[model samples]
Target chain A: MRGAVMYAPGDVRVEEREDARLVEPTDAVLRLSAACVCGSDLWPYRGIEPVGGATPMGHEYVGVVEQVGGAVKGISPGQFVVGSFFASDNTCEICRSGYQPSCPYSVIMGSIGTQAELVRVPHADGTLVPTPAMPPADMIPGLLAASDVLGTGWFGAVAAEVGPGKAVAVVGDGAVGLLAVLAAKQLGAERIIAMSRHEPRQRLAREFGASDIVTERGNEGVTRVHELTGGFGAHSVVEAVGTQESMMQAIRSARPGGHVGYVGVAHDVSLPGVELFFSHVHLHGGPAPVRRFLPELIDRIWKREIDPGKVFDLELPLDQAAEAYRAMDERRAIKALLTP
Target chain B: MRGAVMYAPGDVRVEEREDARLVEPTDAVLRLSAACVCGSDLWPYRGIEPVGGATPMGHEYVGVVEQVGGAVKGISPGQFVVGSFFASDNTCEICRSGYQPSCPYSVIMGSIGTQAELVRVPHADGTLVPTPAMPPADMIPGLLAASDVLGTGWFGAVAAEVGPGKAVAVVGDGAVGLLAVLAAKQLGAERIIAMSRHEPRQRLAREFGASDIVTERGNEGVTRVHELTGGFGAHSVVEAVGTQESMMQAIRSARPGGHVGYVGVAHDVSLPGVELFFSHVHLHGGPAPVRRFLPELIDRIWKREIDPGKVFDLELPLDQAAEAYRAMDERRAIKALLTP
Candidate 1:
């Protein structure tokens, strides 16, 4: 099997790797149909996060189950499925309560990188959601989006309590943020303000239901959000960028009693407790329980109600995996889909 | 009028002050019936927070409406009332959203000092909630508790989303935390765990509906909480101590997808964003929009359904205001009542 691996910062390669095999009866071997580089992958690629030595890359994936373990009850071979980045036995208390990432039996799926031709998924029945029927080829990317980004963005919107009549503000221009805008719109938000400096991202943000755009950054951006929200701030704000500046902006851009749903993985960030206390906003977000939303998202994608696949502006063959990483790192592409 | 003033840290005095008078059409003068020392006041008194020169102290009070400015409606002179520490117009969007402390027309009543014979309250019509009838002398302390501590504790419980079948943990033994235990019980929490080491406070917590007690602090305390909740954590946690240790304990004590409602005035706290992000708990708190719960709290106090006044362990004449502050500051008293 061919898989992408990163040896060091700015060094990603596609190479032949050992075949993925099942070690547990609850596991399923998948022949991944589609996989993509995630924003978080840039953490190590840009040297911001350490590449622990030839680490396998990619977590988001959608594929057909090539083999299933005896213990897997709900999933079987020949069915296309979407699984969460975190494998959880969905029947656990935490998973039942809709926080699968924190499930005691959960396993981080990134360790079994899906950027390969074959991937082994554990807790198959609880972690994978099968589509009602096999979809057309064009819907593959959208189905893949449901595996992580779309579910994550949907979780962000729900965490922020975006609902009818809410004025939402998104603090990042990444795929997740743009999708969050779409999610807020779908969740019945009355208005959405996307904060993006890039023209291409701004246009996509608008198409994703952003009613307004603010090109400013930092304090100025927060001030613009306040002004746009009648000096009260937005009713809901989604933070997709993990930087300190983005987190503060998200917090400051929400009105008192509003919510700030941050999906960004925080790095070297320390929030001043005084400011957060005085902000009087509800804060909720973390590693999204993507498994919880896979079914609904798959349904929406199957019905063609949403086109999250548009985020993949660049697609490359498995052999061109390095180029895919470069394109996304250099901002030449929003996201890159890989086909084996 | 006479008021309690802190000339410097540990140097409080009872001094003659100007008679309370309305400065705006929205102001009202109240003849305070009672006032009490708060744990937050100890911050400035013990010097963790600055007592910037002769600062008039105290915000909680139960009083009689002495006079109202021309614009005041809904409240009248001679009416006994209970008001939140933060005076708000209550009609603004923020107030309407149940966040009165963040209301644009809000005024910090602490600046005016309710620990006096007479005090001026801004936004009278919106700030003061009249009791059903003049309360008997014995009920004064309970009503006074509702003005701030009771309301704050109730808000903390409500913010933590305490309800039937939820396990609640309170992270302070102060009057507010004890009251939160009561609030959680009233909110139908299945089990209330009060985190306190002091024997008297632990006893009071038990009386207030703490089904269990965890005397350990910091990491060990969190361990005890997990052990108690089937190795998970409490469904709800109320943080009434603003220090880093207590904040972390509250966050760590809550299960994933649980809630943490923090109300203690944060002094020098800084939250590690990454840890908070991984905690995956809903966080909500602040100065607590006490006004939001004032009406129901007052009614409960009036009907004698809850005896919040039990938190006040010491009582003294207004002239001994200095001693009242000292007793609460020294932890010799859970709360101290002052009467003119």
Candidate 2:
């Protein structure tokens, strides 16, 4: 099987690797149907995050179960399934509390590298949610999106408490942020503001239900959000960029008693405790418990109620994985879908 | 009028000040019945927080409305009332949202000096909540407690989402934290863990319905909380100490989906964003918004359902304000009430 691997900064290649197989009693081997490059992947690609050696890449996928371990239940061969980047036993106390990413027995799906011809998933019964039926080819991208981005965006909206009559502000223009706008809209937010200066991203944001757009950044952006909301900042803010500036903007852009749902992978960020305390805002975020929203997302995708797949602006064969990474890294593509 | 003044570190004196009068159409002059020294006041008294020359001290007070401004509607002269340290117009958008302390027109009651014979309260109609009747002399302490500590503790418990079946952990042993234990108990928390090493405070905590007491500090304290909660941290954590160590302990002592309500006035503290993000805990807090809980707290105190005033271990004439501050500063008294 050929899989994407990174040897060093800006060094990505598609190479032959050992075929994946069921490794545990609760494992399932999946035949990859679709995989994609994520913005987070750019961390190591751009050398912002160090790479030890050759590392298998990719964690988002939607595929058919090719083989199931003897101990696996519910999931079986020939079933189309979607799984979160984090494989959780869904029934644990933590998972039951809707924080599957922090589940004690969870496994990182990225380690298995879903961007390959074949991949092995552990805790199959708990990790994989099967579709009601084999999804059509046109639904593949949306299903793949549900594996992480869509569910993540949904979690961000839920964490921010975006609801009816809420004025929600999104602080990033990435796929997750755009999708967050969609999620907030779907969650019944009365007004959705997308902070973006990029034309293309801004357009997508509007299409995703953003009622307004602020082309400013940092403090100016926060001021604009406040100005748009009558001097009281937005009631709910979704922070998809984990930089210090973005986090502060998100925190500062919320009104007192507001909520901030931050999903960005934080880097070298320290929040001034005094400001956060005085902000009087509720803050909750992390690597989203994507597994918690997979089922509902899959249903919405199946019903064509949402087209999160639109986030993938480019698609290529799995053998062109390096190009996919480059396209996403260079901002040439919002996201790149790979087909094996 | 005579008031407590902090001229320098450890220099507290009873001195003459301007007599209180209604200056604004919405203001009221209150003849203070009782004023208590707060843990926060120790910051400046101990020189942790800077003090300007001859700063009029004290913000916690229970009193009788001596006069009402022309615009004051709800409150009347001769009424026994309780007000938060921050006076807000209660009708503003922020106040309506239950964050009165952050109201656009909010005024700090301490600036007028509550530790005096008479003090002017601005926005009287919105800031003061009158008791059902003049609270009996014996109930004055409890009503005074509601003016700040009890209300703050109750806010912390509510912010922490304390409810039936939830395990609550308190991160301070101060009067506010002890009252938080009481608040959690009243909020229906099934188990309350008071983090305290002091024998008297621990005993008071238990009397306030603390089901367990963990004397360990920092990481070790978090470990004890986890051990007590089946290796998962408590469901709710109230952070009543603003230090970095206490903040981290409070965050670390909560389960993945737990809530952390922090109310201590944060000093030089900055929370690492990455750690907070990955904590997967809901964090909300600030200056307590005591006005939000004043009514209920006053009612509870009046009915003798809760005895939060028991936290005051010392009483002195208003002229001995210096001694009152010294006793609280030296920890010789949990709290000291001053009567004029």
Candidate 3:
């Protein structure tokens, strides 16, 4: 088997690795059909987040179950499935409340690296959702998107309480942000504003149901949103880029009593309490509970109701993993799809 | 008219002030029945918040309408009313959404100083909710509580999403925190945990329906809450003290995906984004939309179903306002009522 490994910042290589095997009785070994480079991957690739020596890369994946341990009852070998990046037993109080990211018995599948030919998924019965059947070959990218990005964006929208007749503003133009636009649209937001300066991403944003596009950043972007929403800011604002500026922009871009759903993995950001206290906004976000939305997301994708896969602009064979990382890291591609 | 004025930190004086008169067409002049020294007043008194000049102090009041401007249609002279500390038009989009504190035309009643014989209330028709009729003397204290502390505490509980079968933890033992326990009970919480170290406040908390009391602070307090809830923390945590430690404690005391309703006037606090992100908690709070809850709260008080006013541990005449402030500032009283 071959897997992508990050030896240092900006250095990624695909090398022959030992085959993945089920470690726990509740685990399942997956022969990955497709994997992708996530926007979060750029954090370490840019050296902003520490790259521990020889780290296994990738968490987003879609694959067919190759083998299952004795205790895996719901998932079986040969079934095509999409699993959340965070594995959870799904029966805990946290998981039942739809916060699998912090589930007491949760496991991070990222530690096992999904950008490989085979990977072990823990708590298979709870973390993986099977497709109705073998998804058509062309549907792989979209299902793979459901593994992380699509579900993440969906969570952002849901956290913002996006609903019919809402005016939504999305910060950041990365794949997650773009998909949030799609999620807001699906959630019935009446007006969608995508904040982006990139023309290509702007076009894609519009295609994904953005009613308007504001190229400004920070305060200027907030002002644009207010102007577009009759000076009340947006009813719901999604923060997909985890930064002080983006978070503040999202907060300022909402109407008093509006919601700011931030899904960005906050880095060196510290929110001033006084401002948040007086902003009169509802704030909720974190690493998304992707597993909670996987079944619905898969159903939507299976019915061709949404095309989240369009976020992928570059596709490569698994062996060219280095090129895939570079393209995404350099912003040359919104997302890079890798086929194992 | 005599009103409480803060000339400097720890320097409060009851001085003869100009007569209160209607200003805006929506204004109403009220002959204050009662006013109170709030926990927030101690902020400036303690010199933690700046006292730029001789500022009039106090916002909580239940009064009889002495006069009303021509445009005041909903409220009239001779009506005994319970008004929110924040005057809101209550017709704006934000107000209709139940966030009167951030209404575009909202006015802070504290600036005019309700701790006086008379005061002018703006947006009277919207800010003041009349009691069913003139209440008996015993109900005066409770109705006055509804003016601010009760409403603020209720907002905290509501923001924390307190409801049946939920575990609620209140972080501040102040008047507002005590009343939040009352609010959580009214909202049907199955278990109410009041976090307090004071013996008197703990007794008051129990009277207000606190099922348990934890006397620890900071991390130890969080651990105690976890121990109380099978290590999952409280489902709803109300934060009533505005400080870094209290805010962090409230957040830490809630389970993942739990609610933290904070109502303290934040002085200086900064939340680490990374910690909040990983905490997986939902945060919503601000100045209490007291006007939004005034009607329901007043009704409960009128029916004698709740005794929120039990939080008032001291009462003084209008001229003894300085003593009232001193007692509350010194933590000798949970709250002080001033009869003007």
Which residue segments of model 3 deviate by more than 4 Å? none
DockQ of 3: 0.92
How accurately is candidate 2 docked according to DockQ?
0.90
lDDT tens digits by residue: candidate 2, A23-132: 89999999999999988898899998899899999999889999999999799899999999999888889999999989999899888798899999988988999999
For candidate 3, what is the recovered fraction of reference interface contacts? Answer: 0.93
In candidate 2, the residue pairs with backbone N, CA or C atoms under 3 Å apart (3 or more residues apart, or in different chains) clash, namely: none
lDDT string, candidate 3, A1-340, tens digits: 9999999999999998888997899999999999999989889999999988998889998999999999998999999999999999999999999999899998887788999999999999999999999999889999999999999999999999999999999999999999999999999999999999999999999999999999999898988999999888999999999999999999999999999999999999999999999999999999999999999999999999999999999999999999999988878999999999
Q: Chain A: TM-score in each candidate?
A: 0.99, 0.99, 0.99
Residue B199 lDDT in model 1? Answer: 96
Docking class of 1: high
After superposition, candidate 1 runs with Cα above 4 Å error:
none
CAPRI-style docking class of model 3 based on DockQ:
high
DockQ of 1: 0.91
Instruction: Estimate the lDDT of model 3.
Output: 0.94
lDDT of 1: 0.93
For each model in turn, which proportion of the native inter-chain contacts is also found? 0.89, 0.88, 0.93
